[model samples]
Target: MKKTFQYVDYLWDEAKAAELGDDQVALFLYRSNILGADLRITNYGGGNTSCKTIEKDPLTNEEVEVMWVKGSGGDIGTLTRKGIAGLYTERLRNLKNVYGGLEDEDRMVGLFNHCIYDLDSKAPSIDTPLHGLLPFKHIDHLHPDALIAVAAAKDSEQVTKEIWGDTMGWVPWQRPGFDLGLQLEKCLNENPGIRGIVLGSHGLFTWGDTSYECYVNSLEVIEMASEYIEKKIKENGEVFGGQKIEALPAEERKEKAAELMPLLRGLASSENQMIGHFTDSDTVLQYINSNDLERLAPMGTSCPDHFLRTKIQPLILTLDPSDEVIDTEATLKKLEPSFEQYREEYLQYYENHKHANSPAMRDPNPVIIIYPGVGMFSFAKNKQTTRVASEFYVNAINVMRGAEAISEYTSLPRQEAFDIEYWLLEEAKLQRMPAEKPLSRKVAIVTGAAGGIGKAIADKLVAEGANVVLTDISQENLEEALATYKRDEAAIALCDVTKEESIEKAYKEANLAFGGVDIVVHSAGLAISKSLPDTTLKDWELLQNVLVKGQFLMAQKGVEIMRKQGLGGDIVNIASKNGLVSGPNNVGYGTAKAAQQHMTRLLAAELGGDHIRVNTVNPDGVIVGSKIWEGDWAEGRAKAHGIKVEDLPAHYAKRNLLNEIILPEDIANGVFACVGILEKSTGNTINVDGGMANAFVR
Candidate 1:
């Protein structure tokens, strides 16, 4: 509720705005950033801003008034001019006349398209009409947590009058569309002196002649609501104190989350369709552990805006409060009946509310799941949607807490929620999303992902729309690699593949992250170059453990999870060309890799019945960006070849028929091609050695 606006920053933004040819667009971006930077004001992609401005048309060569509203697909925090859609006001106003007799969203969308001022501008937000109908020059609409707390209260109108006095107007719940926009306009006209309006069971709206004035109006209103909620909490302290809530210790929570997340994910998934889970944050725990969770959690979302993201009601797991440890087997047994009951209730709710022309019902699977001893698990078709739903639900819990502290929380009636959920405008948002990539909805795990070829493979998988869990012995390196991706789908697990417990934990993390593993890249290995006579027993054993034993454990763990889910999977092992053809002074490393190559074929034979494919990539002399080929190992290999360390790469490349140096990415490309693109060819070795005549698999 604290105001974040600074006069100096505002002045600086204004000074920079004059330099951009489109001042209105620049100012809109600036104000939107200020609003988005504060989560208490608005969450990711949850709010919008607009400005009415004059621009010269390219064809007409005359100035026309336009409403530049936030576009549909981008976040406001980093909004650019391209993120705002430009619509000709004169043409947009004409929609009111035609739209009165229309209820079809597709036709309304066509009408909206016809009013665009610029053909290349992005699609305007669905709420564009609400902004266009208002007469103000600047407008801001947001779903602030504090304001939502007030809006969802049972006596919201009374609270609005008390906190906002005559400056605010209240409108009852109406699905966002042509009619709703008209209703908002009517409210403003009737209350000529009101500074803003509260959309009951929805959000807040404020406007002024300038962007700063509108921004200030939003802050002041939200602060007022916060103060009211705080006062209520103080007065009703005794009433709130009666609720019994207990939190598990941090270590216990972590242990329980690992066991429960995978079971929840597997239960939520079906053939060719999977849902992932994330339990890293404390927000979910704080809400799920509350004693009042059962009474308040079943109440619908804080606003209709969240219906498309989070379904009407979250699925609550039945767990005994006193049980300190989660028995995964027993929990799954109990969940079977509860899941069936939840599905029945969900379908009945849909049948009770469906109209003749309603769109097809979405899957009945739960979007949010509450785990008693651990935390909450959010499930979605992919990683990004899962994260977004998690964020919204967390904010909803905060709003619920505030509302309950003052009065009982209330959302729109169930029928109204159904209407919003089926509204064509809302449904279009999902239908218009870009087509999925080839590996979309797939999950991959890459061992030795801290650097070199393993890191490159992880990057390639993510680019193809696969959620990846990068595992390595070095936690620091894993974190640094994870930071570069900037995606919620990419996670890191510090794992030593030689240890059974470590390998199991990594796969569990992957399951929790992306439901189940479909692709496994066994790229963790160590290179120890030494002559057969000089290699001691300890050195040879170390190489064998890391390369041969480590790969076996990693592959076994991945296959077990895949088999449980009953989904066909892919496993690609990274082996060296020396495994096929012996090279001087490469005894320990070469022998271990040879064992790994044979093991790949054996595993392939065993798992083929389950439709699981196993393959290997033999990459030779891949020196560039390879951490394994650094320091003493590189110098020793070069010395054995009678060449300087700097000249070793050229020496190896010149010996190959293609006469090209192999890089880490070349190996990564081979791995991806073997497991991802080649789908039919398994138990085969793909040689990525720049045409090594002797190392060929024949």
Candidate 2:
């Protein structure tokens, strides 16, 4: 029978390949990029490609064989020439004569530097020897789901023989170092015509005399394995034991995920604050809702790259997404103990596998969390890292599915997982990473952020390493505002603060995008100027709804997400000096500002136990770049003060104690202080009014 799914295809473009002519490095990069473009062939940063090129040596001025391989931390899909490390092939081959055997692998890494042919090439990865030792002109090492299925299966060796016979080879699990390189060379010598080798419970290696041949050989093997697995899956007739629990409705699953992510983020951040990413795609939903999920999930992932980023295992939450009775409070209470237990088990695993000189146990928290009928959440120090972890785990799930369809799936043994996780090489990599920014893992939401003070606040927060969700009532403004930022640094959510549904939806957007909120700024407000006689019930209600009620709704929803995250948070309310000083023709706007100020104090006192600080920034006049001063409000204030609308800026500046102008940027600076600097203070007011005697907090 014909299959419903597709298989990997040959993407080698002859026209484009011919354009490069005989540039071996360009051809090497081309083959690697096409292989990586389709994730079904290999995961991002999971595979490497290399080629032997004849280049003139600077010292000898003679053509010599040099190997260019993908270096440490380079993703093949995005690989450039700069990402390739070039080394003398003769030097690498010579190291075998002075080989120190299995115990001396770590020392070999430093020795590769002496083999460098160029001073500006990238830092070579540990896999350098695997490519250097082989005599082939071109080589590719990929973690394709299809080949890894054969590699991870219980009968992995037998499957390798069944799929390709003597044409491909097999070797049991070995750490990637000098010894493993020797084993691959040994495999090739024994099987002279072999075109590839399968690393048991690891990945695949294929090579050819030229780059095009290498590209086709890799694709051919992956396509063959994919067809073999698809055939067996058809014969077996069921997957994951036929899915015991049906998935929740897509929207309901999204809603449940929004509820759970914040709580999970809080639990995962016990050691260090973490950012989060969530996904409910069909791939994850299929596994988590399966009858075999309980049995298979504990088997964990079989590949090293998968587990290194996702951890040795993932945590499965008890609350099913399809549960009819959703008692949110009870669900929250029950999650605490589960997270605690997962942490305990992680510590126990570390203890069970530690070497005498193993690096200290790392954050004993789960990087990936799953729930039946819903989806998975992955957390890390930043959004991109969190997203990558999630992607790696999904790759792991596919590897398990392919392995299980034909034969039982097996994870790397505990000791092997530990060895790779705590290797001295990995410790050095971490030490080389640059120090993190102060707000590295923080997520913030700024209301009315499309313009004026809110826009400035959002800009400042992003500059300081915070991921911000910019929300405003106008969709046009919201889209325009977020255009200035990278997708990972900022996002837009359409919000109307006066409407509860709008506020709830926006908060949920924040939860799904960047984990949870650590800082909340309510800068969405409107202003009006009216004398006691002219201020009608309609004008008072309008001002109250926008200034007072808007701030209240934002705080109410923000505190809910912040509390779920369990980390302390800051809430900065953009109030004004009109609240503290009595002024003519300001009856409606002044009273509303007063209410917003008091609400800040009340919430600060109430949420103190939760460590959620509430503060206020009162700017006397921010008319220069303010959206509030654009229309009727500017005219009303100018008419009452006996000044032209254009002169209001000078008028306000001269009246202040400092006789200096205050702009929206000044208001934003005050907000940064409340959230970033004034960590010890709450329920306090910082006046950005350039000094007004009556408006002083004291």
Candidate 3:
């Protein structure tokens, strides 16, 4: 029987992190899941996960020692303490620096001798030796699609040099057990104080002092690789159109999908799920039926990391697999010789290129194969594996198809691939490390940043080390926002959000000033109280333009810039608490604000594939440094309620369970949380409104 896997829904928003008992754990899981799905870093059971904690043990009655890594075979999506096998630091370190040469099997057995497995079901993760080599408190490792795409290429070494430069140390892939650990030891020693490591033909390794830090760094580094590959693919690809596979009837498609699953399962092992991604995307469909697919079949993957799922080559689909044209019987006939030929070629290549210590030989069944007009297949041991394989294949197919229009889609030669495949030192180094903030290389653009929530979010992002572009409709307010921060880390942009032309001009100026924009903060909004009956068309329009249209335009233009640069950015919309929960008699204002939250989700859904994260922050009647605090609005509300504005602050503060007043910093903190200042969050509206809506924000 064939089994199918579907995408899992996990929280990846900043505000949502507050709900988790341990934010760092939540962050790690979110990042690990993304990387797992990405196809560059991890495929099936290829990577490992770990986190460090300073906890008091009941038996010892003191703080306990060491980190806990996810036990082997546990999915990254729902990892828990039981899934983590605790490994003492001293034991792991001792295993890494062992000087004597030993057989690969001996080393593997020796490494496992240290692990004291608690549960009968739990086995220590395969990358235990690699984990012991990193110095960070928390770490994550994955064979990300983009990183693998580059690493698995024939000219991977040269490609890595051109793409990553000296920032990340690249190690050639070695067999995944003990020897790889030794290789990482040498690379880490050479690149003192390096943040992360990229394993050629393998995946990526990143770390930070905290889980959030490590997770964000993983996102950042892989994103860099993804961006590089996307550009190269775009520049070099030709638009070889594909056929419409989705047009097949549901029953027929399902049966076809079922038939293909066993072949994929045979290659991936029965433990894995062979996910089917029959896309409506023109590019994918077109590539499935392209006339050039046969010629390009031997071209292999866009990158090598996909090998875990895709293998080095895929079965090309130049004809339909329907009963009329091609049946399973005929499919088997075609695949038998092809499989034999592939095995012979692979074995000969390995025999000729073998080094002293190399990875154990596996089967030569194609991990990926084309199915004519129907689509493609990626064989993996499980759902995570299948998902990653699907992603990699789609990206590669897209790149290859696109590049076909412009140039020949050639990969690096077999010798280079063999070098990465057999490189001892490189495999040893692919361990998890702590994540860092995502804003290190980013330039953020913030509007309506004249010292309220905008200033607060900007300041927090800067503290986490992002270069901020703080903008406001008011020049004085913009100056005020600038005055509160270091001049170099932050800049000021002046523009009214209501005018599309002004919005365009401001973005252009910000880009010119900062070189590019990787994140956006829309804090510019209008606040006026009037019953729906009393509201004028002008008032409604003004509110709509500033609060709603402002964000839309910013996102639309911001996405364009981010997409072109290959740096998928984040957008934080400053909506109001009224948007989500019930509030006063202002109709236009509430509607506009509510619309902002939905817009955030829309953008996130639309641009997620492009690597952009979009979210909203709703503050409840905040009193952060603004004219509203001192002006008629505050006094009028105070008088209407028969209380002084001074007293209103205390009254509101005491309303929440925390009994804390929502400051500009609080709202700002919400914004920073969205910009990957913290590792987990998106498509959420954080309430900085003194716990106004118990039903909504926590």
Candidate 4:
């Protein structure tokens, strides 16, 4: 008989499974992908899945039981065969004799090396023994919100029996270790014929004789729990004790979030700079707008992963967005002390629960901040980490809603949460992470980023580990250009530099996407080759708006953000050699270029006290991949030189000392040199025009 689900999708495709030809490991990978595809089932990089299969040993040439499980830090949704570690089940089980007790369970992690059946396997996880020691051929340990909702209920043990009856067993809260594996084994032995079990204040475990059966069982249990929770919630007829305050108007909400993100990011990054993510997502708004936000947020997250990513508790601000007008100054004043108190409390938390072997307390700042009328902001070391941290908190909110509707919600015990946070194994894992890149924790904003020089600069910045906001006047161009970069380290926002509102929207997007900009590159401009007589006021004004005024506005906004963040920044202007070596028919265009270069010097002089650097990169003839040269400008320039438009590149190259052509990539290199390499030099020009003597600045 086929089964249908209301809460979770029935994603098991038998025909697709048939394509695998019954290799247990291949089947395990397929099932793992399906389960992980839904956040309702498991969060990113959370949970564990394994299959114990009969395989032939290379040495013995005989059958042996081998366990293949998800390696540490692997996301099952994107897991490949290489991401799963293989171990000999007999070796895992043999460790039981040497295992001292719960106190010595962490040592077994080191012993996992001797059990390696696949020498090329990925690093093993703490849950390896939980899978290997179980009698079932296939096992799934998932953090489904519906199951966690029940597991995190105040009366979870009684609630588990009532919801699942005698079929699903229950074990009280215990950290993942060899000891918990034994407890699970004991539960299954005590209750014969049960299909699964729920770990209190944790997650769920369901197993089957076959991979397909295990997948189906997991779905059945989760969907059934969802249905029951929905019914009880309907009976209760209220959520989060009803809404405490109305959500601000949608547009107002975004503006409010934009205003708050940079300030909060500045406060949170006192110990180490951070990248931030903002969400007024339906789930987040629903939770924060409720009366229970203050009550429940302090209870902390139920899932260990959520708690670890979002921290033990979130910092909830008293700002009410529904007020007719908000006092920004008052909020700023409150934030200073709120941050101080949060750090002190976090330190106290560590001091209270830490053991002698615990690693030093990490950054005591809050990872999540909640505002009543606005939304949530989560900060971390990079863009992806911030995004994933926010998603984990959303999952926690879902668990809270479900648990509270049916019964009182429960968080992990304080000592247990602290133990998991300060675990020696976790410290080792953190120590194993690769060193950060030169531009790590920095965010850059690139105007004219759709194509040409702007895109090149954005790409280089991202390569050096900076998060980027790709801003351009054309939306269609921005989307097409952004798609090519193909990484989460970059974002796109449509912007018209001539307009202050457009520029504000771009900065808002940048602030929300990856905290605020630390580097600003002004690459958005156009060129015209009209002679002095041919240049009309309209032509003159167009150049000024895009070239001169655009930089003015962009710089104005960048300074505001950088000042608020209190982090020194960089502003690189992509000027032209025309600014220096003025010639025929260049009156309007050359004046604007000169203004741009001078503006760089003025800003550098003014901003130097704040440690902000301003520099310029001058390129004379960047014709290839150059949109500016594709039109009347190229025709006009070629006409002046008495050469065909096609000959412009060589014509300009011959004029330079190096006799070399300049590309957008050369301009991009200059920008990197200013921000990444020439750290001490500012108010200076780096000419990238193949050594143009006439354009050189002493």
Best prediction by TM-score: 4
Which lDDT tens digits does candidate 4 get at residues 1-698? Answer: 34788999889887999999879999999999999999999998989999988899999999999999999889888889999999999999999999999989788999998999999899999988888878898899999999999999998899888888999999998899998899998999999999899998899999998999999999999988899889989999988988988888888888877777777888899999999998998889889999898899999998888887889999988655753323545666877898999999999999999999889999999999898878889999988888889999999998999999878999988899999999999889889889999889999999999998899899899888999999997889988988886556789999999999999999999987787889999999899998988999999999999999999999999988887777788999999999999788788899999999999999999999888999999988999987888788999899888999999999988988999999998898899999999889889999999998788798
TM-score, predicted candidate 1 vs. hidden true structure: 0.91
lDDT of 3 at 274: 26
Instruction: Please tell me which model should have the higher TM-score, number 3 or number 4.
Output: 4
**Which pairs clash in the backbone of model 2?**
none
Task: Quickly count the clashes in candidate 3.
Answer: 57
| Model 3 TM-score on a 0 to 1 scale | 0.46
Candidate 1, 583-616: lDDT as tens digits: 8998888899999999999999999998899999
TM per prediction = 0.91, 0.92, 0.46, 0.97
lDDT by residue (1-698, candidate 3, tens digit) is 11121222222455655566575545556556654554334554557777666556555677655666767656564565556676665656765455355455344534664644233324575577677666677787775656665655556667666766766777886646667766777888998777777776566678888666776667667666666756765764534543334345545544454444333333333222222223324455567666676667676654444443466667653345564412445655555565567667777878887776776655555566666645555544322344456666776664454334323455546665665545443344232323434565466888877766677777778877677778787888777668877535677878888778787667655544444567888887767666677778998998898888899999987776665445457888988777876555568778988899899888888888887888888876577474435564676456645688888778767776678887888887787777765445667777777666453754
Per-prediction tally of clashes: 0, 0, 57, 0
> Which has the higher TM-score value, candidate number 2 or candidate number 3?
2
Poorest lDDT segment (10 consecutive residues) of candidate 2? 1-10
- Say which candidate scores most in lDDT: 4
lDDT of 2 by residue, 1-698 (tens): 11123587567778999999999889999999988998877777888999999999999899999999999888998899999999999999899988899899999999999899978889999999999999999999999988888999999999999989889999999989999999999999999999899998899999988899888888788878898998988989987887888888989888988877888898899999999999999989888889988898877788888888999899988975665324546766878788899989989999999999898999989998998888889999998888889988988888888999979998899989999999999888888888887678999999999999899999999988899999999999988998899858988899988888898999899989988899999999888888899989999998888788889888888888887777989999999999998989999999999998999999999999999999999987799889999898999989988999999999999999899899999998999899888889999999999889988888
Alpha carbon lDDT of each predicted model: 0.80, 0.89, 0.63, 0.90
